[model samples]
Target: MTEASMRFEEGEGFARRMDAEDPLRSFREEFLFPQSPQGEPLVYLAGNSLGLQPRRAQQYVQEEMEDWARLGVEGHFHARRPWLPYHENLTGQTARLVGALPLEVVVMNTLSVNLHLMMVSFYRPTRERFKILIEGGAFPSDQYAVASQARFHGFDPKDAVLKLEPRAGEDTLRTEDILETLERHGSEIALVLLGNVNYLTGQAFDMKALTQAAHARGCRVGFDLAHGAGNLRLSLHDDGPDFAVWCSYKYLNGGPGALGGVFIHERHARAEGLPRFEGWWGNDKAIRFQMGPDFVPLPGAEGWQLSNPPIFQLAALRASMELFDRATMPSLRGKGDRLTGYLEFLLDRLPSGFVRITTPRDVKARGSQLSLRFSKDPRRLLTRLSEAGVCCDFRSPDIIRAAPAPLYNSFQDVYRFVKVLESHARD
Candidate 1:
């Protein structure tokens, strides 16, 4: 058989062989994989966008629905895993995923909302030193949030929000450039807010080094962990940021529109006089049901909560967190690194200009996603790949994102993805 024909005939069996060897292969059964009308699984490589739902999520949510139907108001206290303290149960797992202490992390509102709340406390800007620095090409949600916040304070975002862009012709930002920007503007910057991983380029920033540098300049630091939460292991406590926020729907496998999570370092736990966006849920936990006029905030990250937990959303998160707890981040990250590296290796073997990896090649510089920038518009290739049953995502202009999630993706998935790419290139 010719090489191309052999690849097609042997690809599925080869991939199944790799799946058999995958340490995390068992985890794949935990999620509800998308199937064709005939019930066969589709090759899923879009975990970086919306993860497959955990099979246990329906059962978890069903329990809540039954409790609400049977117990009504009493469900808050009488149900198994009482609704009153439900959010607390997932803290330890969430902390483990993000490399922070249980007390430092909390599940609350969505990503953008948590960011605004974090800024209420962390973004304390003054007349001379009021600028905030962020990585260039950050998610539009973040850019809008920062711009609106700056405008709210009478600071022009054009001036108050300084973006650290890569040098001309470079796809990813360099650490040296980031640090240099800090060094030059550190004195005037109040807070350094950056994404732990860049969304489009899949570049994972050096959090520990960057946070430490920002602190030395007396600037508060925070992170938007939308891309890093499940894709990479973060030492959030050790890195010591003022706060961080992330969404659970991506690599966490919490389904679409999952609730967001937040982390606040323990050092700020008992801060008596910090500004916050207040609500009843953020009041003293002990006195929360007392229904009085006092405004006592809960300690640590929980203090940022402004409303009651969304039990249905929390149920989905809880189911996913259980799976995460069973498999730690280190093991997951290890698998992801190898799987993505394999994808990179195969892509590099292709002809020059046919495909160029926009995501950094260095293992330390990226997470599971390998962004491919085709020499021409990539949408045609994306549509072709989709029709062929290889699932990935396309960003505007020319980038296509493919991720190999350790939780559900198998080695064969990577193998087949390459197989499809080879076919697409020739077409």
Candidate 2:
């Protein structure tokens, strides 16, 4: 059968046929999935949360452990991956994933730590222009980081933070309203900080437009790309945000609490005058061993480093990064759009008022996620999925976020997931 003819149809039979034709279907076997009572792999749709671990991660991690056991201190230089410059090896692939220049990206601390560090450098607040403009209902970690940053700079979170909420009776922020808010409050704002993708609503912002607007208003801009990076084909370099940070654990498929990534625009990559928290590891590489009590920072984003990177975490991440290197964002995204569109199509067939799809219907404005908003308690439905061996996440109040990641998830996985969802509605 023609591959095109096999794509995008309703029901289990067609789903199986489409899966048979998917070029990326084998990628799913590379990761381990949760099992059911019969010891069968469950239908997983929760790549938006913590992603499944890559089977290759074990081999990569074992190499580091063997080096540690045999060479002790010498492993720093002798190890296969070489701990001293481990992070450098990841630069090329990571840069390609986010579409940034190699010098502009670095793998560092966890998501929140990277966010605070970026804030320290770019969120320079003045008495007149001290406020931060962000969307309301941002991930709680971000809200806390911005508030503390305001307090540390001697401003009240109340007066120093401005939130842009959806219009009355709305579920997400509108881009026009964001532009208007910037126009009205632009002069008083020092920084425009926002999540590249709203975690709860799954709304992807027009980052290029937002960056241009903020730059016009004389504000430094940055993005928390924890939800956006591996999911979207972003052009961070061309988009021109001053800085951006993201975690590798979600769609990047690194293990939990895996290292995060940071990107500083080449324009500010080596700005000597930029204010940043100093650390010994960030000192110039040539004189790093000299350690002469004075600090001369590295030329680019690596200058933000605080210490030698954790080699174990970097190794675990390398396994999945290599997979991403093979699949490539464009190929994965092509399959992703249709896989998610099929999920949306089936959900639309749900009985009236059973749920609402909160993520943008316009595919350009969202990634793989579709936030299902149910009037009935979402946890109740979650309990049902849990018993039946479906792997999806439930958020507070009412959101069940199902993401069929293109790299590993198949059309039949989406079909089976919806079939179970339909069964619950009938009950």
In the range 1-427, model 1's lDDT, one tens digit per residue, is 2112223223457556656766787898998878744466877899989999999999999999999999999999998779998998899999898999888999988999999999989998899889989876999999999889899899999999999898999988999998998899999999899998899999999999999999999999999999999889889999899999999999987778889999999999989998998899989978888999989988889988899988989999899899888889988888788777767767777666788888987888889999888875478787777776788988888888898898988877788778777776776
C-alpha lDDT of all candidate models, in order: 0.87, 0.90
Task: Please state the error at residue 34 of candidate 1 in Å.
Answer: 1.2
Per-residue lDDT for 119-209 in model 2, tens only?
A: 9999999988999998898989999999999999999999999999999988889999999999999999999999999999999999999
TM-score of 2: 0.97
Candidate 2 clashing pairs, residues 3+ apart or interchain: none
List runs of model 1 lying over 4 Å from the truth.
1-17, 36-39
Shift of residue 67 alpha carbon in model 1, Å: 0.9
Worst 10 residues of 2 by lDDT: 1-10
